[model samples]
Target chain A: MARRSEHTREQLRDLMLEAAEQLIVDKGLAGLSARAIARQIGYTPGTIYLVFANLDELILHVNARTLDRLRVPMQAAVAATDDPEQQLLGAARAYADFARSHPNLWRACFEHRLPEDVAGPDFIDARIAQLVELIMAPLARVSGAEGAALDAAAQSLWSGVHGVCILTLTGKLHMVGGQATEHLTDDLVTHYLAGLVMRAAPADAR
Target chain B: MARRSEHTREQLRDLMLEAAEQLIVDKGLAGLSARAIARQIGYTPGTIYLVFANLDELILHVNARTLDRLRVPMQAAVAATDDPEQQLLGAARAYADFARSHPNLWRACFEHRLPEDVAGPDFIDARIAQLVELIMAPLARVSGAEGAALDAAAQSLWSGVHGVCILTLTGKLHMVGGQATEHLTDDLVTHYLAGLVMRAAPADAR
Candidate 1:
């Protein structure tokens, strides 16, 4: 079926991303190629050029798409929660689950190196700030953690979750055994969260 | 310079890892090859076969050596700290520093998918657990943080630091101008530590 001119751009963009995603799934990021994407998406190589200036632009678009998809569930996970700790956990779980299910796209989101000529948009950072916003205010409200301590806690929590996501995504967690991974992650999160709360509780110090 | 068999094996292993490291530095991991390593190390292709079964083993040996090197600095970082939060931060900083300096090996450590025939040794878990011991016990003692909360906090901190490390290593943070990468990392670490403490604090009688 021929794509009409009005929606051809949108259709082609989606097609290109879908094609690239498939290629990555099968061959990893290095396997992606404009010619292969063109062939797979049923577009002539010239048509891809019409839609994307080059492969970098196409990759940037797909990378943005991956971040957008990740942000949605992360926001939803936090927004649906009222307890600060619970909210953090919800977001963490959502992040881990999404990363696991969409390993290729997720990998592209984090691991893809931007070429010298290209710059990604600021939308991804804004999305992260939104997720961070969900947790930060509640943290600042705590009496004892009004400053630097609060900041450290947030950074710590964020890194710990990212480690799990990365380890699971790259299949590194498998080396430790699945059950051990689960247990260790659980222990780590529990301990870190306690540290966070303790730092903010002056009268009830650790 | 012909040498004893013992010296030959030691020199070969060192040569292999040094060559692989240079290759990664030159062309990145995707361009890595056993043949390239053999050539760079001044060994015939067949000579590489004696030190390792194949390219994958060679890469793994290099990665393990890198990790072992990292463990020393990381342990020292934690050893220099007595406070719980400081201990955690010191370890995280050490980890981040290693990632920044050895982006290729750092990347290899997390990208741990195993081919069917490649079985890993089992001691890495115990080594990691040693690191965990440094961060876990002190962190878990915080107020308002019980079992699960503590665990989540630890996990989140690990992930957040790893995220920053990877982003910095891969130049994902290059777009953020004005501040040096070290400054940005410092800011990230500081805020994370604060946030963790804030989150863990229990609200009670003022």
Candidate 2:
């Protein structure tokens, strides 16, 4: 009895996504191709097409997992803390942690753009947006920074976390010495969030 | 007789370096291969070799120019300010400006790993080290911060600035609106420095 689909559908789906992710880690998105993925999984390109719309869609699919890695940790961190400020900072710390833990996947999430059919103007899905929203939601409630400024600060927070994450990914930061990554990330999160909260004493910092 | 070596040694050197820089700006470092560069200026790759040795040598040659790009502005910023704190801020701003102004070149300077022949342990280069030393020299004078803790604080500052520069480069900050990049970078710089300065004053923050 030859098993054409020996793996269950869910298992096959994970295998496909995992293969695509490892491909990106081994070779950047530029090097990804349906044939390459098929070779990795012992499937024909047709099988890959059955699983993914194309490489861009495939990457988007894997990036969702990367974002999930970030979101789950952040949610747990937020849950761990009762204070809003600490929760926000904790979310930031979790972000840096995920980034360090999964540097390649993290890069694919931020740097990878998906095909139009798959992502549209927003993203591969609402997952990253949802995570960003979770981070900003508390700040928005407390600061009253609506629409653009709130959005800007939210985006700024993304960069703040991301900035430290990528630098720490590189061996370059090793020269700076001892938990510099953690300390610097903590500083950015605390100060940037504090600035957001400083709406109480609003000045021309705008 | 076509005018033999029509360009002077220095003239030809400048022209090739200029072409290399333009290629970096228009395309990334990946696009700045020797063949691509030779075709751009209608010079044979041999001519480029005459100016420099191998690709690694060529990159070092380029950084000779790249460091100039980084160094001059910092020098000018330092000249313009006398207030220690403001001077510090301006220098940080200048470092950011250098990155923004020459994206490809900065990418070249930081992203490339120097070959082992050049990057020996305890190896420090004058160009970048000079700039970092200048930025941290003020903190060295502030008597409040002593020995190892001060070293840690200054290292954090460098990491923060480097972190911000990288995040901005990848276009990750694009989604956030309202002067986000500049504002957030400034915020990170100010706050990280503030935290460093506050290390002496802060009995309660602990």
Candidate 3:
């Protein structure tokens, strides 16, 4: 039997998703499309449309998978240590490592923008929330921040770490001073945490 | 008698650049191309090729102009305040404001990537360096850091701020939390500065 006749809808979906991911990994978003994915998986472009509502939907699925893969290392980094400071640093490092290792896939998670009329699937937002929460747990412990305060602190700190990774990968880091990406990430996490601790301190203590 | 006959090569380059920028402003990078620009300016695509080597070269020129425009407000921010903390915050807010107001142009500065075979012109790097130096001067005053240490401090802090702006614009900030972008930016700068101050403190005082 030919390979096309061997699978059901779910299996075909998986195969298509895998191919789309591989294409993005190899060539970034520019190389991704129903036709390209169909060619890779031995299916017609029409078949891909049957599996995915549109290219935006397919891209979201790929982004969701990338986020899920990213969560693993970050979760492990948090789990590997109990000290809040170390946990934060470890998580930051893990994020930088993932961005470095999977540069293209990682870029797609942020770089791909949907059309104005399209609504992104909610699960993508949920996955992002989960990762932010993982970082928040350690940050809350370190800063003693709660509710919205904790939310802002965690988000800001992560944004800083994320920024370091992005500029590093884009070759913009050297345009400033050529600091190592890891060191910049480390500095951001440490300094931000120290700042949080200071703010949380009683005025008399300072 | 055609509109194309009304300009010298330099004037045509300016007209094409303006059209390209407007297209980007209205529809982002997706809408930009030599053909589109040529059409908007009443010239043929061949005319664009005559003035610029390729689209990437034109984009670099556009980005360089954006950087130059961005420098004006940042320099004014730094010069506006004598306090290092306020200077840093002011410059950051200026960046955020510019990104918000001219989102397409600002995004184009970072989002447009040159082909792998092309070498980015040196002037782009120089433009970026000027902005980094603007941030670094305030940081050095605040942190008492100098040499490579100062360079690292400035780069890390600015990277963090840049990260916040990117995430906020991309809607990732809301995914993490609902804090306003400006407030989150305020938090990152204030906290990071506090951390730097704490670290700079004498051991006993700290």
Candidate 4:
């Protein structure tokens, strides 16, 4: 943990991000600060400011990394099956597993908000779009949905699955009636998809 | 404001909650504290503590009130229609409307986590159970779902609707693709219910 004598700017940035991610993992977002990250990495607070535009920028970068990590399991789940229902279910399960295993990190990704003056970064949006497509593809196959309807379908189903994980992690799920999280998730995906298929082709339904 | 000598403990507790709620409305949960609440209500921090065990307890009380306030619209929405679909939709709309109007209070209800040593109060659970019943009743009517399946259905759909509101308020929904929050919610409820009906009487489907 020596000072930055040998590190390039990119290397220093990576080091700072690694140290910050560890701090967030250990303490959660409330306790995270530029000074804390700097201290953990043996650098001055000023050095962190030099690498990132601000604290919000640093947090966004951290969230972006978390999103990238999240994509691995989702991709594998999608690739593991040709059946769209199983694919979607696999993705949902992977999502829940990721959140459970890295509760602090996953929470930080959503809980950290950019300030009013700063626009949301495009990279975060891009990452989210990628994740949503994992659902949208299977959703399209299941429902024959396309255009705005398909988009709406994907977002809603994704939100439902996301909600199940979030409520479960926060202990809100148990407040109503403690069903198993995985069961609720399966119930959500299975039922929502069934509903989607029924609604998809009016002629077929009739 | 006069000092607390004129008021009984219960009355004083009411005053403190009113003041704390106003503070939360203006400043969100980050700035809430006993000192701030006491200062607003013309009492010392010790006086505030006398009425509540700790800050976490006070927050739980505030969230309970929010839950109560939320039930008004949900109840009205359920009563307005006999159709199960409309009933569920009305309740979902009421929920989204409440979140949009009282974003801070609604967020605080979910966002506030009790300390590790302090167990969540029974009253909060009671309030949530009442709220979930609004969805469960219509859900039961819609799908002929009963018992554990009924319970899981109600909880998952509720979570999906809640997820829409949270992500919409937090700007995370737009990151995936900026579909209308209401639309996503409607899609979730409609499709999930359809799926539920299909699954509930598998014998009928064949």
Best by TM-score: 3
Report, for every candidate in turn, its global Cα lDDT versus the true structure: 0.63, 0.66, 0.86, 0.85
| Predictions in order: chain A TM-score | 0.79, 0.80, 0.95, 0.94
lDDT tens digits by residue: candidate 3, A21-97: 99999999988888899888888889887888888888899899999999999999999989989988998999999
Query: For model 2, what is the error of residue A67's alpha carbon versus the real structure, in angstroms, after optimal superposition?
Result: 1.8
- Model 4 segments more than 4 A misplaced: A1-6, A175-179, B1-6, B175-179
TM-score per model over all chains:
0.74, 0.73, 0.96, 0.94
Clashing pairs for predicted structure model 2, backbone only: none
The C-alpha RMSD of each candidate to the native structure, in angstroms, is: 5.5, 5.5, 2.0, 2.3
Give one digit per residue, the lDDT tens place, for model 2 in A1-206. Answer: 14346877677668788888888777655557888877777777787667666666777778877777778989998889677778878888888887776766777776554332432435544775777787777667656677876776666566666666665555544443226667767766665555455542356533
lDDT by residue (tens digit), candidate 2, B103-181: 7788777655554355512232566556666766676654256565555545555556655676655544555322454
Interface Cα RMSD, each model: 5.7, 4.7, 0.8, 1.2
Q: What is the full ranking by DockQ, best candidate first?
A: 3, 4, 1, 2
Q: Candidate 1 chain B: worst 10 consecutive residues by lDDT?
A: B173-182
Model 2 accuracy (lDDT, Cα): 0.66
lDDT of 2 at A28: 57
lDDT per residue as tens, model 4, A1-206:
56755777898899888988998898788779988998887878999877898988888898999999999999999999999999999999888889888877898888787765666889998998899887888989988999988988888888888888888877776633234667888999999998899888786553
Taking all chains together, the TM-score of candidate 3 against the true structure is 0.96
| lDDT of candidate 1 over B1-206, digit per residue (tens) | 24324347868888888889777756667768877876676667787788888777777776777778777887787679677666666777788778777777777766644563555645554454455555566566533455655555554455556766765565444333323334444544444555455655555532
- Give the runs in model 2 whose Cα sits over 4 Å from its true position: A1-16, A27-35, A42-57, A111-121, A124-128, A137-158, A174-178, A190-206, B1-17, B41-57, B60-64, B113-126, B139-146, B174-178, B202-206
**Ranked candidates, highest TM-score first:** 3, 4, 1, 2
Candidate number that wins on DockQ, 2 or 3: 3
